[model samples]
Each structure stands twice: as C-alpha cells, then as structure tokens.
Target: MIDTRLSDPKLNDEQGRVLALQRYQILDTPREAPFDRIAGLVKAVMQVPIAIISLIDSERQWFKSCIGMGDTTETTREVSFCTHTIQAREPLYIPDARLDPRFATNPLVTGAPFIRSYVGVPLCTPDGYNVGSLCAIDTIPREYTPSQIEVLKSFAALAAEELELRRVAQIDFVTGAATRRGFTVEVDKAIARYGRYARSSALLVLDLDHFKKVNDTWGHAAGDAVLRAVGAKLNALLRATDVLGRLGGEEFGILLAEATLRDASRSAERFRKAIEAIEIENDPPIKVTASFGISAIGPEHATADQWLAEADLALYAAKRGGRNRSCIAPSSAETQLSRPA
Candidate 1:
C-alpha cells in the first residue's frame, strides 16, 4: 500500500507522489537517450560510478534513466538517499555516508549497496514541490567544494528543463491540449495503464464550423481571434486533470480521464455551447460554433491507435451529419472507416 502517514510540508501526497510522477510521463517507459545522456554527464562531472534520475513514486523510486546500474528501478524509498534529498529540498551532501550521523547506519551505506559519499539535488516542480532528486553516489568518502555543489545543482536544473521541455513539446501551443503526436502518446500511456489496471477513459474530437467563412467574411485576423477566444474559454472551463489541444486548422481534441459516456457527453456539450455563445466584436459581430465527436475506450480493443481511429471516424460522421452538433460513436462502430453523421 502507498504510505499515507509521512506527509511533510514539502512533500504532500498530491503534489509529490501523484502530480510529480504523472507530469514526467516517464514512469514504466523503456530507457531513452536523453536521460542516458544526463546519467553520463553526471558520472563524468562528479566522477561517480552511479548516477540516476530517480522519481520517488508512491511506493518506489523509479529510474527514468540510469547509468552504471543494471536495475531500472529500486523499491526501497524508506531507506533511499533520494528520499532525504526530497524532504530537505536541498542538496544532501554526505561527504562520508559511513560517518554522517543520519546515514552512518543506513542500509544503503552499511549493507549490500554500500553507498558512501553521496550528493543529491532535489528535483523541484514549478510549484515548488520537491518530488525527487538527481543524485550521484560513490563507494569512497569525498568532499565537494562549494563550486562543485553549485555545478551539481546546475545539472539537476538541466534534468528539470528536460522534463519541462517534454511537456511543452507534447502539449498544443494554441489550445494547451495534446497535439496529434502528443495525443498518440497519451492514448498509448492510457491504454498501457488500463491494460494493467483496468480503468475507463474518454476521447473527444472537436472542429469549428464555418471557420473558413469567419476568415473570409471578417478577415483571417478575426478567425484567429475566434480561435484564441474559444481556446481560452475551454481552458478556463475544463478540469485541471483534463487534457485539451488544437490539432491544427479548426480541429481540436480532448482526453477526459476516468470519465463515463454520460459525464463525457455533458462536458463536450458544455464546450459546444461555450463556443456557440462566443460573439466576436468589431464594428460588426461575428459568432462561432463547433461540432464534436466523442467516444469511450472499451475493453477487448486491439490497440489505442485503433480506438482513436474510431473516434476520428465518428468525428467525420458528426461533420457529415451536421455542422454544429455533437455525436457519440456507437459501440458497434469499431472499424477504421467512418459513416456520414
């Protein structure tokens, strides 16, 4: 079970365990090149045999990437050096773990792992939650000068930047939703989690109607205005857990976590009506509206891509059926192809 008793001011359950782990989207992923580079740089800079980008999860510290270590993850947070680093929200420098009062008797130092000198910089979120650490360990006692510690902190910052860049690259710049590529990654993650834990989720595809007409009549500037307006309104209305993105043109998408068809439909309708009510103003008023296709992932599906393709088919059906209405994909519409709405 996940530990609930050790709540500290710097590491609340939501901020530290849930949000921190979720933001990276790195948990359970196969090793990657960028993280490998981070590990390599840490080893070279600190001259340590072990370096890791460890994320402290609910029950374990998972390595997104590691160097000079065969295991991808370690399951002992209660005794982890990273745990102390997170709690301190500072670099935990034990120049000699075997002599340090707090860690002299630590299993990591006294037992099989035999960690000695250790330096860890907390991996902090933008909101100031210190979730984990980027750390290096050696088998011998060592001291880092002030300059060396600062350099280690800089490396930790680089790791943080890698994480933030991953988010920015995946999220839609215009609407803050997942871009097409990002959506694919999301679906893959969702399906993997569902396959493991058996959870339900929903997807919605939206396209603005008569968007070209808005550009033609009011000029492209007005069209841009309408898109931005709609995007802002949606961002304001959706739950923080929900993901939204514009996928180019007047098309957009949403991933509604842990939502049923009824709940998803309610949310999609709210988005629909919100856009319908957006009245653009100049000397003349221009109004905009959108159509949506919504669907839920069901078990026994072949893959996430196939499921998304079905949703896209339903989107085509909604467009064909009517320009400004919402349509839900019937469970029977499981094929790659779509029908007219």
Candidate 2:
C-alpha cells in the first residue's frame, strides 16, 4: 500500500520571515537575463523538464524566471513544494512524489501538472533566512546523488549573488525601484521584443505634482518619504512583466510590456487616484498628485531616448492643461502631444 498524508508546512516568525524576504525587494519583478540563464542552465544540466527560481510569499509561490514551464509563472503556496524546502534551509530531494507520504496527497502530484521527482535548493540570504528555492521538477522517478545536490547549491549561490548585485546596481536606494540606467536597459529589451514580435507596448513618464512645495514646506526628508511611498504604491499595481523605474527625482517611468494605450490610460487613472489617496502621517500631513504622459511603441522605434521624448511631450501637455491628469503622445516618433485625458 502507498503511504498518503497531507502535510501542513510550518510557518516560523512568518511576519519577520516575510519582511526579510521583502528586504531583497525582488517580488513581482520583470524577468532578468541572469536569473533566466540560471533556470535554463539548471534545466539543461540537471536534465529536467522544468526548472524555476521560485520565491515563496505568504499565499503564493512566484517564479521570476522559468524554463520549460511556458507562460505560467506561479501557483498557490499549498501546491508549492518549495515551501517545504525553505523550511529546511537545505536541498530537499524527492525521488518520487507518489510514494512519498508527505506529498502523495498533494494536488500538484494528482492534478494536471503531475509532478514526480523534485530537487529544490534553498535560496538563503546573507542574514540567514531561506526566502525561497531553486527547484527542478520532472514527471518521472529518478535517482540523484548528494554530489548533484552540491551542484544545485552552487547554482543557487550564483542566483543569490545576482539578486544582491542587481539590488545595488539597478534598484533605487530610496524608492527601491529600478534606477534610470537599469530601467533603460530593461526598456531597450522590451522595445526590441515589440519590434520583433509585434507586441503591444506603452511607456508612461510621470512627474509628481508640486513636489518642490513639499520639500519647501515639510523639508526634503518628507519629500523623500513621499517618493518612497509613491514608488511602493505604483510597484504594487504592476504586473510581473511590467517595469517601474526612477527616471529622476520626483519623476518616474513605467514600461508596460504587452499592454495598450487604453490599458495605459486606465493605469494612469489608477495612479492618479492612488497618489491622491496617500496621506503621510506627519504633524502637517502631506498629499500629492501626478501628471502622466503616455506613448505607444511601434515596430520601427529607434532608441529608448526617442521613445521617452515622445512620452515626455505628452507629460508636458498634461502639465500645461493642469496637473493631476494623464495624456497620450498620439504617435510614436512625433513629439506632437494630445490633449489631456
């Protein structure tokens, strides 16, 4: 008889555990080449059909990059075996899921995506918390040596290093969004993909409304707080494929890959509302608004700078008409702007 049991993964200091994970500030981020390369390397070297850089949160496991999984990027925490790996802080190897009492009854094994063998190495941070795992899965039972587990740990080390390196290079120290240079690199790739695949894309350049007044009245410290809050709010609303960056002080940019102007407009309106709703809890409370300019990318786009210029024009129009609104550039190459939306 096959052993069958439903195991409930334990959560320890789950609040601080989540806060520790957030310190990396990597959740819901766009796919990066370094991470994708690692996942692909694991799939090829380990000879598995599926490999993923899985980050486990309170309710779900999100894959920043995956190999052989197609377009699917995540699953609920209940179905995530990585959840168990993180709890051990070491590699968890299951030669076969069906025969394992801990996982035999799990939906991931019995359901459509029938997972059999699994090897997961914990992604441990310098501060000694395992936020997630680097996992490879297949639909067949297989034997893997401890030596193989060592190699998995080595690859996971590289991934952790890449995460830290990107945090220093790409992330804004204050807002925790991509810096201007980092954002440009990502946007360039999106533009190339749009040109090659004929995918819909949009860019938004946003300037905070009356930011100078905040610095003058409440002090630059409060101004910094406001920017940080805005970045956090906007980042939450983005899809995993979307990129948000600090283009400059009190101004930001968002690259909406596989999205249209109508979608961009709705996002802009949402931003407008969210910004208006922010109430900083100082003695003198602070509230703010933003002006957004939208530009749709075309197949023949030349450079990131050119596209940004188009969106900048649209933003200028929004400011000219009045603040706290969004506008579109009307065309890709032209600097001509349209009326505020």
lDDT of each: 0.78, 0.84
Clash pairs detected, candidate 1: 177-244, 177-245
lDDT of 2 by residue, 201-225 (tens): 8899999999999999999999999
Off by over 4 Å in 1: 1-13, 74-76, 98-107, 332-341
List model 1 lDDT by residue over 210-329, tens digit each: 899888988988888888888888888877667676767888878788887777888988999998998888768888889888887677555767876777777888889977888888
lDDT of 2 at 48: 92
State candidate 2's TM-score.
0.58
Task: Quote the positional error of residue 115 for candidate 2 in Å.
Answer: 24
